[model samples]
Target: MTEPTQDSFPVTPTNKIRVAKRANYDRDTLFAILDEGLIAQVGFVLDDKPIVLPMAYGRIDDQIYIHGAKAARMLKKLKEGLPVCLNVTLVDGLVLGRAAFHHTMNFRSANIHGTARLVEDEKEKYDALVAITDHLAPGRWDETRETTKKEINATTVIAVTIEQAASKIRGGMPIDDEEDYDLDFWAGVVPISTSFGPAIDDARLKAGIPVADSIRKLTSRR
Candidate 1:
């Protein structure tokens, strides 16, 4: 077997953790959490007010790509080289404790801070589109029809370099007071996961066309 490639993220003021111990600067850990998540919450300032909106994204190495309609307000603002805080999180489970105040969640999350740049080169734009597609549905990009120039021109893609990023994870059972451990309340972890269900055929699918093998593998894993 080949050895896994490793990369490390740099610590910066924006990504430094107060708790210290829960912070991770390892690239592998950050990438793993990012790959498992589909949506990213991008925070940026608009007219001196901070805003955060969830959007779909794809990652290639240390760069993350996000796209939207050409006229999207957020994308337009991001293209101006504004500071961005992109965050992705995966909720693994809910930790129930005897005391409501001790209840918490088991999660893996990454916070990436950088400036957003517009992707303009044709080749890179096409590759970014493919990455986004493959990230959402692995292997489906090749099975789909080719992208038209008009379609590509109408969409705007922004690339955010991972200049400063960090990962934080919390797992296992909840921490409760020693006296609360003997309480009559039930306490444990309730696991949570996103799973693919049975594939649904498109209404317009040709009768002779069968389910794609890539989709079969995707659903099977779930």
Candidate 2:
């Protein structure tokens, strides 16, 4: 039990990382992993069964927001203030090793434990939607059409204030036995990455309309 630094979240028993070497509790490290990820897997118990669903999310400081249809089962259950776990992972590469048992993937992942509650404030809900839209593509919310009141009424948004979080990162080459090095089996890392392709236009899109600057900039960087 090492104590967490002031900048890191406290390492409670539920959030403690088993492999201390791979554990990262620094605020920057945890936030970076979460921000870079596109999808979060939310886990919770429902009807005595564990359910995990992939969702798009937004982060506002320590709070993470997730939304769905108002009648969706996952959202319905989470809004009851039940405990939940959220996980986001970005795979960097495939770590190939001489021995099958040593093969692994290079990745960065963040896990959060918290209780979710329904967002009742109108302004906060609107801001959270903007954050979620922009998280998909920076500045996307502003470039798109305004959200109608009816649409907002049909959506259910829940906010989870991160109570405990930890990140685990694995990188570089795989670790193989000393004797396996001379076995002549090829071993190396196969790099992997996610990139955006050329933007496609909608079939019904007006001919005079052009791609938005946000999309142009995002695709250019990728």
Q: What TM-score does prediction 1 earn?
A: 0.93
Q: Write candidate 1's Cα lDDT for 132-159 as tens digits.
A: 8888778888998989999999999999
Which regions of candidate 2 fall more than 4 Å away from where they truly are? 1-6
Q: Estimate each model's TM-score.
A: 0.93, 0.96
How many angstroms is residue 215 displaced in model 1 relative to the true structure, after the best TM-score fit?
Answer: 1.7
The residue ranges of model 1 lying beyond 4 angstroms of the native Cα positions read 1-6
Return the top candidate by TM-score: 2
lDDT of 2 at 98: 99
Q: How does residue 61 of candidate 2 score in lDDT?
A: 87
